[model samples]
Target: EKVQLLIARKIELFWTRNFSEAIPYNNLVIGVPKEVWRNEKRIALTPSIAANLVKKGFRVRIERNAGLNAMFSNEEFEKEGATICNKSECFQSDIILKVRQPLISEVDEFNEEATIISFLYPAQNQQLINKLSV
Candidate 1:
């Protein structure tokens, strides 16, 4: 079973490298930062979800108090193996998840080539798209 899993992983790696520009889940550092958009009180991830990702070997980092608005405590996330980090540290992650588009200042904090998963309407978010496109 272990050998099969290894072979499958190898196949997945090869497929990603040759076909898609996708990163392996286990190799990703996923960050959940606090929603800073006006009147936004949502978070991208919850403690239970983060815990599942951790179990799958993904590194999860959540900004301190990111879940406060969602009613999910930092302690809950910590107990589930997610690191409670500051804003800068969270934004530095390889994968940043957010409830809405980030502010300009927040965009500057992302490491080069970082991937952000968030809601975006290109027509209304041209500036953000242009910035990220480069």
Candidate 2:
């Protein structure tokens, strides 16, 4: 029991702790898009994480040039089995991973059931939240 507790605590430390319904990795496609917010130049996923997810049977799609700001090349992601695609294609994935709140136009292009993980500051982004809630 102590060992189990220790391992669980380690997982918790590295986990996002969404505590929501879990989705099978194989059934989901994770996408990493370029941060378009002015002066905010961070990509959501690293090549290592993409490789790990791919190994776990998840499809990872990264937008072309998405990680340029972070110094991650497409070849790196490709080596990890992630598909380099257009921004629109990336946005259509089952899960969109990003660092900034998406613009309204970008949100409109998201897949109907796509799960987006980002820094969504709801209080400051009421309009974005309203649009997303729709």
All models: lDDT?
Answer: 0.89, 0.92
Residue pairs clashing in model 1 are: none
- Per-residue CA lDDT of model 1 for 26-54, tens digit only, reads 88899998998777888999899999999
Our model 1 lands, by Cα RMSD against the true structure, at 8.2
Error of 1 at 27 (Å): 2.4
For lDDT, the strongest prediction is 2
For every candidate in turn, the CA RMSD to the true structure comes to: 8.2, 8.5
Clashing pairs in 2: none
Instruction: Report how far residue 51 has shifted in candidate 1, in Å.
Output: 0.9
lDDT string, candidate 2, 11-58, tens digits: 988796566788888999998888998888688899999999999999
TM-score of each: 0.81, 0.82
